[model samples]
Target: MLNLNRNSHVPWISAFLLIISYSIANGVYLTIERVTYYPIFKSDFTSILLTIIAASFMTFYNYKRYVYLIPLSLLSFLLTSITPLILLLPIAYELRKISSIVGISLLITSSSMLSWVFLRLIANVNTYFSLPLMLITAGVPVLIPIVWFIGIFFLFMPNKKGNKDSISLNPLIPFILTLLVSLLPYLPYINPYKFPETVDFKYYYSWLLHPQFDGWFFYTRPFYLILLYLLSLIFKPYPVAFYEFVFLSVFYVYSGYKLASALDRSIASLAALLASVSPMLITFLYSGLEANLFSISLMFLSMYYLIKKEKITLAIILSLLSMLSHIYAWAQISTAIILYYVFRFMVSKIKPSKYEVIYLSSSLPFIFTGLLLIFMGIFPVPMSLANYNDLIYQIAVGSWGSSNMLLFFIITMLGNRFMKNLLGFIYAISVLGTLVIQPATNLIIDLPLFIPAAYALRYIRKDIAILLIINLVLWGIYMSINSVPKIH
Candidate 1:
């Protein structure tokens, strides 16, 4: 058993770190075992138990005592090297000894060195999504868990006195930094000048030039392509699609900044800067998920404006456009809104505001018109809805490919619990709804991950946040460059 004081921030950080350690390990374990069928929630619960025991052993710093966990740890071998932050474990531990600017500079220096080593030895061959060192690789094997798990705690345990956010009064400093840092990781990925040969891109390109997508009804979504078509009259479809990725990438960070600024102006830019280089946006950009990007960005903006409460009209319009843009976004937004509203009502006994009622009411006519169009054969119904009987008989499986977002999701979900305000509830709902709709798959969960990362930054001093984001960016660069396309 572990010594859990049940006081202060340990419980919350523990919950978050538990997810971080377990998910990385468990995801890898399943991959190594190559199991076809496993209980999702049950296995996750087991990991939680195992992780608690592991963390207890490390917190006590007893090597002889931790020897017992080795057998169990070896059984879960795949989680050895998680994020680059794990690689920084020994260095972060040393931060306890040297807490000066020069010491932190040395930390940054060491981070770069490790990143280069990884790129040369591990990332060059592209063996796995995480660090390549396995459990039995070399040296003291138990030391792997000790250093990595303890480092997870050390990353958050910043010195209390210097913990205030040190964001510049001028927002441009952070904005320019975010842009520059954001640009670095994306440089290698700029290889595809235009859309390459892929199954979906072909139809998307044709739809931009043609008036009717006659056979693509079941699989095609027209509104986003229609927007591209109008844009293409002036520019080429490829360029239009290309720039949309760029616009949404920046906008994703901006939305987080706006939402974060509303809560804590001090760390808003820090949050935005961190969000800028996260893996989700880059992964989607390279995979060419333009509609998903557009709709999700709008949905986040809608969430942001709704929280502002003064821009209700803009919120409604963006919400409507989110539905128009993609079915997946609609599923995500609608599910999240309903749950969020219910939580607010249950907690405060408050009903939806006037603008909220109006927003829901306005969507009705558009919804009816679309259904009526489908009924009249003007537009075909989705294949899933049309072929419900066949779908109902088949097994439903959930998949997640962007291994880059794994750590981001872990941090976001747990950090959200510390938030008791609007940003907390909405994005927490966003995280939950994402899992409900598509698992923690980074499908609808990408933009939502940024807020909590930024939100978590509010507690840390400026210097520490910079250190964290730098380490994260270095990790993200390795992941993005070595990544594969999410969709075929």
Candidate 2:
């Protein structure tokens, strides 16, 4: 059995430290406006050294449990937040424990160092920015909570549990079909060239070279990238990509089924399958942000299990795992929980904690800053906001966002979807659209409004899945459009 007493608070403590370090190293304060450039502590290598010392202390002190490594990895994220930080200390510490640790560390360190160095040395070396990229990097984290709150408020509407349901046996076929169709973008095409060195595959290669790759780009952290790489290896060729997509879709379906089952037992697996393979799920799977999909599904599943079993520890574990997938996942999952209680509190006329709002809003700056750093590399790409605005305009009109708007409108009129739900969806669509407004105005005035608006929208749509889908479609259009020109 796990030693709960010995490491009861370790997880939360680690989570807190991870949040703090992440905020400091990659907060939104750095990204949107470029208020600063140089790191408070320059060489990232030393950060690694310090992180190692810190993790080592925790490991030695908490010998019975591996939870020490949790905070340690969180700290490591801080160390490698800016530049390529040598990870000898982390590597050594991991080696002493798990065998897979060394390989994972190597993959992580090498991918990051090589990517950054390649960006600096090979791709476009000699370019330098006047100030730090803090403002832009900070925007994403800041924006996450804003949007999450909006979703929570929306989801907090009137709904009671239904009757129980039975699970179906043959639900996998449609799930697989829906997933395969969603992955049409990543397939290889026939090349006219003998070596296939050159072809009219403009759409295929353009996104790979988008100049604004970092602005709202997915796969920023090396861990995420490595996950993609390993998933690629395990599943490989192009069809394997379908596996991750299908599996996550399956999880989402199961979660939805379990949820409906709680209310009405006769619920057909079709209900779950439909929810799982919706346009939203397909969109997220294609965008390369698996964590959002995973977390949302887990959060719902956690809620279902929590209600069924009423076990706090299990719920906490599920919640923490969701957080581990992506910090934003924590915000959405936690906000949903709070909103659920808030609704009940309102109904019961119970006093609520004032600090809840404050705590949830705190992580915004950090997520934004992290995103900014990933995009445009060391900050300040050659392209201006005006250039990006035009790009967004072109892509928006021709592709995903507009397409979603049409679909949404159609569903609203024909499907009998609730206006509140429509509002929630629109709010989500707008927050993502906020990315295009980057070059048009200064963030000081705009960010304040945008942040709250995101929250407001989230309040209107507690379903993270809905928000994630809108965002994914936005990302796909951006990538597909941006990548198109490069293939030539």
Candidate 3:
């Protein structure tokens, strides 16, 4: 449907070539490492060869039908590294249509592969200047795939007339009403002592009640802890919990408002309504999980600035703050920021100005704090976490019961006809990647689903809103019935 010129295809072709170059380079390095340094694999070679043959056939079949080949190939890669060659199938397809959706998907896949490589490189490095080497090595894997994907996405994007009032919102009445309604479900479970008594509260509360700055504090969410500590100073435990609840709820509503405004006022109202009643958000609020609340709110706000305002400095600062609130937010916020800049640079030729640089530079203290936490062995590595299968199951059907919402969000996103549709696809793919690659922090994927769902509401507002209200009421009742016992 989009009008395009002959030269538009060049960028996709170039991206395909870049991906090929990286693949070849990685293949060579892996081969040399296996052959010269690592032990010679006799039996494993048979498995690897068989995997290659199987993956090649699968890739060919999927490519012929114009279906996505990366997921199966990615699964195979997990089992045997040789299957990474299947990545070529999707890249080859992108050369034909050059859809931003496809480009974002490839970006996710390549980024995952690069992150794996970086982790391996860091693990293997054992020298006097390993720290500097590790830092430098970290940038390469991220930058290469990022630039390639950004190029394809930007080059092929449709050149439409810009809407000057895109960022404007309608009256605040509807948003306020939505916020009030969203607070209704939590009203029944508002026992401050009981609400904050859930998991992780005790650990965080301990840090708040008795402040200790020296040595390595394994809990790196200092902002959250400090806020809780300040709240504790003025109020009893129950009131402190109540105030925290109100603060997070307001921020969540505000984020939805801003995000929706970027598209339209009606859409913004719908987004705020959804956020107020979202089962996942409500659950976290009831449980007093400041990290999850703050991270999701800040992530949403960061995306608003990046996409709507083109305020790179605010985006970066909020993103870093979100990362500080919870390490789990790093992947979600980072991916969104990267895509935002890629779109901005491509569509508007906008780059970060000196003011943006000055603002971002302000985050150095927080970055240093994170680095210190890492140095003191405060943060746990992926290997130290729960097994992948367990984490995957938890994400799929555990406390974060977002599987149904994720399914609905994906269906709505795919059905919508908008530029933001690509973003929905990106988030959907990231959700899958989070499940398979880094299941430890799976809930972060919920943040991106909001945008598409908000957009979809514009089409089927009445029907969807009715269904959402029914579901919200049922979920609220469920939460109230199964509420945690209050702490003495």
Best by lDDT: 1
lDDT value for candidate 2?
0.36
Candidate 3 residue lDDT tens string, 1-488? 22222334433533333333332333211111111111122233443444443334434444454234435544543544334334444445444433453344334433443444334344532122211111112111323222222323432345333222322235464356445533432443343333442345665667666677543343556666666667788785555654465567678778877876766555676566556555455456434566767777887777676556477777777877777677545544455444554576788798756654443455545555654654465764343433544653443334433221322333234223454433544454454444334343344334544544555444433433344333443333233323334333
Q: Model 1, residue 40: what's the lDDT?
A: 24
User: lDDT per residue, candidate 1, 81-188, as tens digits?
Assistant: 232123224323323321344334435443653556365344444333233221111111223223222323433443344344454535565456445433432343
Q: Which residue pairs collide, candidate 3?
A: none
Model 2, 1-488: lDDT tens digits are 33334433333333223323333444322110101222332334544444444444445446555445535455564445522122222323332222332233324433443343334333533122201121112212322323233443544454333211222336564355444444333334211121111121221123323323233333322233345455555655243333454466667766766654543334334344445334344334324345566666666566565545455566556655555455444443454445544565687775535433333234334435534653546433233433443432322221222112222221222121112332233334333433444422111111112112222222232332233333323322222212211223
Between candidates 2 and 3, the one scoring higher on TM-score is 3
Q: Return the lDDT, model 1, position 136.
A: 10
Alpha carbon lDDT of residue 191, candidate 1?
28
Residue 69 displacement in candidate 1 (angstroms): 4.8
What is each predicted model's overall lDDT from 0 to 1?
0.48, 0.36, 0.46
Q: Estimate each model's TM-score.
A: 0.61, 0.36, 0.52
Q: Flag clash pairs in model 1.
A: none
* Two-way TM-score contest, 1 vs 2, winner: 1
Model 1 TM-score on a 0 to 1 scale = 0.61
